[model samples]
Target: MNFKSILFALTTLVTLSLAIVLNPQITSPSADTKWRAGDTRTVTWDTENVTGGPIPEGMKGTIKLGYLDPKDGPNEHLNWDLGSGFDLNKGSFVVTLPSELETKRTYIIVLMGDSGNASPQFTITAAR
Candidate 1:
């Protein structure tokens, strides 16, 4: 191959390698649903695709696990606990399911930026 072709191939390889090395992309559920109603369901997040800087004061995202109560709000019943939200990088919280929800139910998993739910659209659904 000529010098130009050889140089282009090398550059492409280096670019792809750098992207794989620096960025981590993992999309997995953040809850352990093997427990019963009274049991504590702990959820964890992957810092791979997490933006922000480092741990502790890392990503400015909120990871919530629970079903919101429908009477107050649609799906609001599964909202576990009141004011039980936590900032990302800090750690996970046990979704305190309400008494009304005896069996397992599906809840919304919302991960927002520092600007609350208005951040981007990093939200998903998790089954209890």
Candidate 2:
């Protein structure tokens, strides 16, 4: 191949590699799955895509379980205690569903870090 063609191929490969490496991802709570309040479930993710950056103070990444509703404001954060020394880099977590939700609504599970990766839209059935 000509030098130009070889250069173009190399550039494309590098771009794709970076995209795959830097894209944040969530690995649990599949889209449209239902989560009932008061039940326990595992919230998990992989941060191999974080690349490099300075993580903010008190934030080494976190799983934010909540709704996508704009009216409710900030997506109605679920109160989850990640426990002491919980490593956001560990990529696995067992979580207890908060017992305060009173309505059935679709929710979004997000991996919070330098960037956020959202799970497939899931549902929170009426609190039980």
Candidate 3:
């Protein structure tokens, strides 16, 4: 048997097993509740559930805050603005709310990569 191939296969299996065992968390919230468009929110998140460390000293998480289309069909990506992202050492992170969103519309709060640097995932939604 090829030693290199065996080692690689073992590594992959171990990584996959770890993921299933850890079952890292996905969602987290900020301390300063109540978020409104056109206003800045000092958001925070608790990732200790997924991340095995302090709330602010855990794995980094990216937060994308934006607004979803409010109109009916025929409108797509009308006002989807990706705000400034923060590199979190913990589960919690802060973000600035956009000011050019329509009232009574739906908003999005994405917290992608709760564990690894994988594709954009882990997102939340809010409405006005």
Candidate 4:
């Protein structure tokens, strides 16, 4: 390949990498996170890397709780709406775990709107 072609390819790769790194991402409720049902917990994310600054004020989004079914994949049938109309720029929100939630390690938090982001697998245990 010509030198110009190789240079163009390298630049394109770098740009894409930077774009991915700058996207909003979930920062809390990570893979090791564990919570008890019926307890109030906070979910947070990183906006510093978001392009054009953090999500603008008044821009809202929704958060949902999903489960990873061993037989299937991510199951959103429960439609566990944790919260809605949340200010995305706030970077965090509070959620109360449903007391009826099954004790499992495959629970995940999904932030929807604009560019959706999903947290790593977390655990939710039965309420005491």
> Which candidate wins on TM-score?
4
TM-score of 3: 0.48
Q: In candidate 3, which residue ranges exceed 4 Å CA deviation?
A: 1-9, 14-34, 51-60, 67-85, 114-128
Clashing pairs in 4: none
Per-residue lDDT of model 3, residues 1-128, tens digit only: 79999999999999975555222343433222345555555444444564444333443445555434546542333243343344564444455556554443344455454443221122232334
Provide TM-scores for the models. Answer: 0.38, 0.58, 0.48, 0.75
Off by over 4 Å in 2: 1-23, 47-59, 70-85
Q: Please give me the total number of clashing residue pairs in predicted model 4.
A: 0
Q: Give the Cα-based TM-score of candidate 1 against the true structure.
A: 0.38
Candidate 4 TM-score to native: 0.75
Residue-pair clashes per prediction, in order, are 8, 0, 5, 0
What lDDT does the true structure give each of the candidates? 0.42, 0.65, 0.44, 0.81
Superior candidate under lDDT, 3 versus 4: 4
Worst 10 residues of 3 by lDDT: 116-125
Best lDDT goes to which candidate? 4
The CA root-mean-square deviation of candidate 4, after full C-alpha superposition on the true structure, stands at 6.5
Task: Tell me the lDDT of candidate 3.
Answer: 0.44
lDDT of 2 by residue, 1-128 (tens): 89999999999999975554233567778775777877888887655654542222354556666666667765656555433335566676777777876555567776665456677777777674
TM-score of candidate 2 relative to the true fold? 0.58
List the candidate numbers ranked by TM-score, top first: 4, 2, 3, 1
Query: Per-residue alpha-carbon lDDT of model 1 for 1-128, expressed as tens digits?
Result: 99999999999999875454211122333233333444344544455454432334544444444554446554433243323345565445444433344443344454443422211112232224
